[model samples]
Target chain A: MKCRKLKDSLSAYISEELSERQMSRMSRHLATCSACAGELASFKRLYERIDAVPQVLPSDDFEERFWRKVKDADAGSSSVKALPLFDWTLGFKWGVSVAVAVVVMVGAYFYLHTSYGDKARGKSEIAEMADIDRYLEFYKNYEVIKKMDFLIKLEKDKSLGDNNLPENRTL
Target chain B: MRYDRDTQLMLAFKRGDKKSFDILFKRYSVLLINYIYRFLGSRHKAEELAQEVLLKIYLAKDTYRPKAKFSTWVYRIATNACLNELRRHEYHHHSVSLDASGEENPVNRKVWMDDQAFTPEQSMEKRGFEEAFKEALKTLPERQKAAFLLNRFQNASYSEVAGALSCSVASVKSLIHRATVGLKDKLKDYII
Candidate 1:
């Protein structure tokens, strides 16, 4: 491999990502090359130095303070949720309105069904009217003659009505 | 079982389990805070950013896909949080090195296989070297610094680095290389 290629491959080498074959070729190049070898060594040393740098602990109460800030931020966001409860009330009002509508429908059904219902009304009315007409016709045909006979008898009696007239009666 | 436990834990959090969320926060907070601290060189900012990352996990638990390792996913979130926080503060505009010299820096105590192996003079010399070395680390570009720290300190792969930075693997490689080259140049005088 060329020096440029080996230089670029140093990162992958440190990371152990290069395949065995590629590693071998790069090793061979490094063996023969002075500048690349020095460069690789320095890179390795730098990696080691960075690793050797002591890990620092966070300050006392750092985590606690951090969580406090997070809580504040979260609380800030949740406060935004407060305004939408008004919209929730609107939704509840809609639910109450629907319930009222259902109650009104149920009340109307019973009121209209029993008080003004058309149950057996037509048959009874027709039967009563037919009976009245039949009675009238019967009276016109037979009873009228019988009544006329009685009226004639009464008229004959009326000829003697002057004799049958009570006192203080006008004939 | 581990993956199941984690996924179950996340699902529980999704169902409004604050205890599950607290468990997750406590579980990954140190590593994530360390990752951010290394990136931005500020423990205070790192801790703050770590909390933000946890909060995001809390909010985004519903959409989290468990196809990859949970650590990978959380690291992705942590790194992004650190980056966003750093950007908001514009910390990159002025480089801040976290290292310090001598006994004044609490973290600078030397590791000793044997305490008698080093004299006070030798320890002082080493401390000076370490301080200068840290000074050199500040010379790298901000992206390079982030790439280097995430790759070396976190053992992040190029693909993972790319994932964290929203860049391609090739670009991640270039960033690492440039970072290494910059460090190498700064430390060339002391290399054996």
Candidate 2:
């Protein structure tokens, strides 16, 4: 192997990642090459310098805190699982239910308000007609009446057809 | 005994054994926390993320099938956790400063470097070289840092690195190559 090739493989050689044949070739080259040998030595020292950085340990409370978290998580999960199925409902579900309720209420309100107003107006018209008929019958019992002084709506107006009647027109 | 103990402890943890989790935490949290701290360069964030990593392990215990060695699995988790923390820190435009207070300044307290730096000129050269080396490392991409740390510091083989990093062995070689070239250029003054 040339020095360049050896240099390329030096880290691999140190890491034992090179193939056996490549390792053998690099070893042979290093034996005869002063420059490559020097290069390898320098690399070795640099590696050692980096390795000499002391590994820092965690704080004394690290393990205790870790276990405490674990226990809390465990307890939380177990408590969740132990609760009744109806004990929990997600926010989205609740929002959907509220939305559905508002829609139904609005629909019902419009339906009832329009229908109730039409029914009440029809009942009041019928009551006014009944009162007029009662007055007409009561006045006929006397057989005589003043035309202007005792004015009465004594009969239904038959000029309008049922389909085109003004009483049924809403607007 | 260590492997056996770790395996048993993991198995027990998988079975919802709290004591086993405590043992695993005791065994690995310090190393993992240190690994994250060095990678992220912040004690506060490192501690928080390290706790998160351990918590993830606890949550994932049931899913761990032991297809790989336990140590390898845990180290892979630690490595990924640190990388994520580093990326997050970088995204926020933060630089890591190793706060050396009082007796903690390793360079000033170094006996070997002191002996070699007999003159002011030599001391300047040494300081200049070390600074350049650190700058080069700082400029390295995340993948290169991961490859360098796993390959050199953790003594992981290419295949193991590939497994840990979820990359091909060939990719591992390329990453290490790039990292070594960068480092060599950085430390050229000191080395050559």
Candidate 3:
């Protein structure tokens, strides 16, 4: 009704966004008010100038160039998909796995080197004691072992097909 | 479900009909280029973005549903692309040097102001009008500019603009209203 409200609606009025009731009301107001009519006229001029701005067309190769880009994109995406080796995510995964493995390995090495060394030394001492016991047992029966060694060597010569050797002479 | 012709064409492409896509392309290419050109004020960028929109529609064949009009979907994509570009740079100004080389330059746009039919005086007037129009266009916020361009130049309805902008029709009404008023205030000097 008032010019302020009507002024706000002018844009919608010119563009036909208003409902029919609003349109008729505004139409009636415009007919009575020269000031509103002048404002409407200038807004119309704005529309005309906006509409007059022309379009610029793409070049002749537009479609062709677009198709080419599509083809290149298709190629690029396919190649990336096909090769897991070329995938950055895959590389990242492998890198994380290797880092985790290295961490575990270093952790294991430190754990073994520090806390397990005494256990390993204890084991080696037992092994050394067994060796000593084995040598001591042979020395305890030194004469009998020497005699058994001669007999064992004769048995070995017999099994070696050395029939002509003195040890292999059964008679 | 009933679909618009373009949506049907897209569905047909989804069904492995490449010719349907060709039809859609032929239908939208020029219309889209003009819309983008008007939105971005750059011929080269408009052409580039139009191609991208087509490519997106092509790629979306399998995923597209008849949720909205094909035109609405298209304008949405085009709008998003234009907004991204505008947001990337604040678009400090749009200057056209008539002496500059053709389409490669953003400001070196080809316009009908250079029509041979116009007398030199008329051409000069048209030139001034276009310059003021461009400057006025840059002054509006990006969303207002988008709504104005779609509603004014693209012949989109308030509902259609709302669909494209992902806003309500009431918002579109307000946006377009503010845009028109803003442009009028800024261009008052040159229009008369």
lDDT per residue for candidate 3 within A1-171, as digits (tens), equals: 599788888888988889999999999999999999999999899898778877666689999998998898789878988998989988999999999999999877865675465364566577668989999888878866657866787789889987656644342
The 10-residue segment with the lowest total lDDT in model 1 chain B:
B95-104
The candidate that wins on lDDT is 3
Candidate 3 chain B TM? Answer: 0.76
Model 3: how far residue B105 lies from native, Å: 32
Q: Which of the CAPRI classes, incorrect, acceptable, medium or high, describes model 1?
A: acceptable
Error of 3 at A83 (Å): 5.8
Model 1 clash pairs? none
True lDDT of residue B31, candidate 1: 70
Q: How close is candidate 1 to the true structure, as a TM-score?
A: 0.58
- List of clashing residue pairs for candidate 2: none
Model 2, docking class: acceptable
Judged by lDDT relative to the true structure, which candidate is superior, 2 or 3?
3
Model 2 Cα lDDT, one tens digit per residue, B1-192: 345567778889888787998788777776666656655556776677889888987898878777666666776787777655554544324322212112223332212112222332443465664444444555555556666777775667788777776677777777787688767656665565
Cα RMSD (Å) per model?
17.3, 13.8, 14.8
Query: What does DockQ give for each predicted structure?
Result: 0.27, 0.29, 0.48
Cα lDDT tens digits, model 1, B122-156, are 53466554544454554445466667777887777
Where is the poorest 10-residue window by lDDT in model 2 chain A? A148-157
**Compared with the true structure, what per-residue lDDT tens digits does model 2 show for residues A1-171?**
467767877888877788999989989988999998887887787777667766667777876777788889999888867764544654557779999999999877765676565464566577668989999998886554544322232223333332333454232
The per-residue C-alpha lDDT of model 1 at residue B2 equals 51
